[model samples]
Target: MFPLGDTHGGRIPPLNQILQTVQQNTDSLKTYISAHHEIAYRSIQQHNAQLAMFAEAAKLQSRGLEQFLVSQEKANLHIREIVGLDLKALAREKQAELGKEEMEKREPMLRNYVHALADFVEVVGGRETQSQNGELNVAASVATIKKAEVKPRVWRRG
Candidate 1:
């Protein structure tokens, strides 16, 4: 025989060594999985935090826009009120100017009318004294007075 036991037979590892190696590999795998889980968890948390920040920013932007619109509406209403008041004041000023112009124009015509009426009265009285047509002349004078007393019609646009 070459040897009593086979050569290199005792070089094989024991069962405890194999079991320890498998346990070490399992522990390493668990550690790797735990590290990956931590990384994924942190990523999810960061994403959620970013989403929350964006949502808050959007809310703030919406509120700011609403406030801006409200302020603009208020400004526009104020401007309209100012414009309305300005228009009213301008209308009143124009009305006063037109009244002054109408008065200035009517004054001279009224004076001329008074002078003509005086001359007509003097002539009519003289004619009445010199003629026997007194009744017709008085009737004509009364008719003229009636015509002068009538009010002039004024037309206005609605």
Candidate 2:
């Protein structure tokens, strides 16, 4: 027969190779855990950083919305003042001088002021979901006020 004893292999030195293989497996497991832990820590840090950025952005957006509301209030006040002046002019033109006709003519404007003032108060009163339309609704309010008739008062014509 052929040489069968030391031909292909001679048991292949099993002891030392087995020990080295076990050590390599252990090392690989340790390295994997370390790498995984590092990745997890980095991911947590990144998420926390993004959360902070989003919070800051939300704060800035809220501030901008507040500024816009303030500007709208100012504009409404200006319009109301102008409307008041117009009422005064109308009184002057009629030569009523605070008489019945003048009062009647000014009544609608007064009502408009009341409504606008109420709306402004409601919006600025810090209630939830305050009016977002702002000064845009003032014209509609004015029109509504104007439609109400002013009752004529009896005058003594001094």
Each model's backbone clash number: 0, 0
lDDT of 1 by residue, 44-152 (tens): 9999999999999999999999997776655544433332332223323443655755635544533444345334444444331333243344445435533443211
lDDT of 2 by residue, 12-107 (tens): 545676688788989999999999999999999999999999999999999999998897667756555534434333324444445675666666
Mark the regions of model 2 whose C-alpha exceeds 4 Å error after superposition.
Answer: 1-19, 86-91, 94-158
Each prediction's Cα lDDT score?
0.52, 0.56
Assess candidate 1 and give its lDDT.
0.52
Q: What would the TM-scores of all predictions be?
A: 0.48, 0.45
In model 2, residue pairs whose N, Cα or C atoms come closer than 3 Å (at least 3 residues apart or on different chains), thus clashing, are none
Candidate 2 lDDT at 94 equals 43
